[model samples]
Target: MIGDSGAKSLSEGMTSMHELTHLDLSHNNIGHTGAERLSEVMRSMDGLMFLDLSLNKIGDNGAECLSEGMRSMHGLTHLDLSHINIEDSAAARLSDVMRSMDGLTHLDLSHNNIVDCGAKSLSEVMRSMHGLTHLDLSHNNIGDSGAKSLREGMRSMHGLTHLDISDNKIGDSGAESLSEVMRSMDGLTHLDLSHNNIGDSGA
Candidate 1:
């Protein structure tokens, strides 16, 4: 519930907690400036494994700054950036950083404006994240092209067990492609493709 406490407070208080493992700053009004400053402090917290920055007003500038901070966070396992104003360019930058985060298992980027370009960028990097198990990309604009691309990229994620791509404008072709990929994912147990355009044949 620490929504509007600003970045100065976070930098001052969060930097001292070197042993902190999880930090949730969701619903905050923190923008690019605050995010940039907070990112600098987060680089020192080596024990940080989970971070939630959802509902922040962070855009591409903030996302790029955060990516820089995330590069040093090798121990990070779970990350949530949902409802942020991140787009395809920012997602690409984050994807580059994610390649180094081999420990990352869960990621949430829902409720944003990420479209086919963003999904394509994510798919390119997700191929190397073998430890990732849970991923949420719902409420975006990913279409059949993005779904097909993601299906191909996610084939390497053998550890992936949960996935959510609902409300992404996926049609029958996209669902067919995703279904085919799901059949090969032995670890996948949870999948959410509801609210899409898939027909009975694709279903």
Candidate 2:
């Protein structure tokens, strides 16, 4: 449930990918090559719910392949890809997927190097995502503009409960942006802003 070697065995058990509901391939070395194989396997598994691929080497190319597979995964609820080293374009592709995937409730992208552009793309996704309850974007390069984008995009979102933006270089401006979001977001319960460079003026 936490590692990758065990996930490989589970992948092998997926003969037709029908009974598989959850798949956690986190901390694995499943780069582009492995993602290619995963895409093939996911084609038949339309019943997947929770998929965790955090701490892996799934870069932009691998993420793109995964997004291709995600088109068929209509049952996916939670998707974790923390520290997966995805670039802006890859995150944009994933954002496109999130735009249409209404079943996803939790999305984790912490520790990845998704920059401001990536955050912008995710903002686009947030506009269309109606079921997302938790979203993690910690340790990225999201700054004030990205924070503003998130706040603006989340205006229409009514399901978000938890928002994590820790370890980013967000300034007081970003904090104020999030405060604005908090004003409109009555559903948010847990908001993590630890390790950021926010000032007292944010409150």
Candidate 3:
């Protein structure tokens, strides 16, 4: 956990180290300033495969900045931005940038405020990523409509194997929709829908 560390301390003198593949800066208090500065350096770290920035205070502005810098990180396979205060607009921006990340297989955006719009936008983009296998959108406020939209968008993701949408306000209707789609996803091995409103019928 790199929480509370100033941006200058994190990125200061951190020059080119192209071989770096994994970096975890979770719980960091790096807001817009740190995100901006780090993004500038990240542009050159093309070999980065995994990055975790969960629990950071970086909001939409920082997310936008990260999106711009991550455009060149084609090797990125896993990314975590949970609890970063990302909204629909920021999620859209991230989705746009994610189009370039064909190799991305795992993503975690749990605990954010992403609603129907954000989930729909992300689901649309996830269709283009055939390699994506793991996804976590738990603890958000996605309602039944958003869950249905996600079901529609995820229908084409044959490679997806793990999914976690727990604690989202998904009711029986949403669960039914998801269950229907799950029939087609042969690769799906793990699913977590705990803390939802699904009843026995939906199960």
TM-scores for every predicted model:
0.93, 0.90, 0.92
Better of 1 and 3 by TM-score: 1
Residue lDDT tens for model 3, 1-203: 44335665667656567788998888868888788888887888899999999999999999999898898899999999999998999999999999889899999999999988898889888877888899999999888888988888788788999999999989999999898888988988999999988988888
Ranking by TM-score: 1, 3, 2
lDDT of each: 0.88, 0.82, 0.88
lDDT preference between candidates 2 and 3, better one: 3
Quality of model 2 by C-alpha lDDT: 0.82
lDDT (Cα, 0-100) at 27 in candidate 3? 82
Candidate 2 residue lDDT tens string, 46-151? 8889999888887999899888877878888999989889988999998887766778899899998887788899888788777889989999988888888888
Ranking by lDDT: 1, 3, 2
Residue 166, model 1: lDDT of: 91
Clashes of each: 0, 0, 0
How does residue 46 of candidate 2 score in lDDT?
Answer: 84
Q: Which ranges of candidate 2 are over 4 A from the true structure?
A: 1-15
Give the top-scoring candidate (TM-score): 1
Candidate 3 error regions (>4 Å): 1-5
Model 3: worst 10 consecutive residues (lDDT sum): 1-10
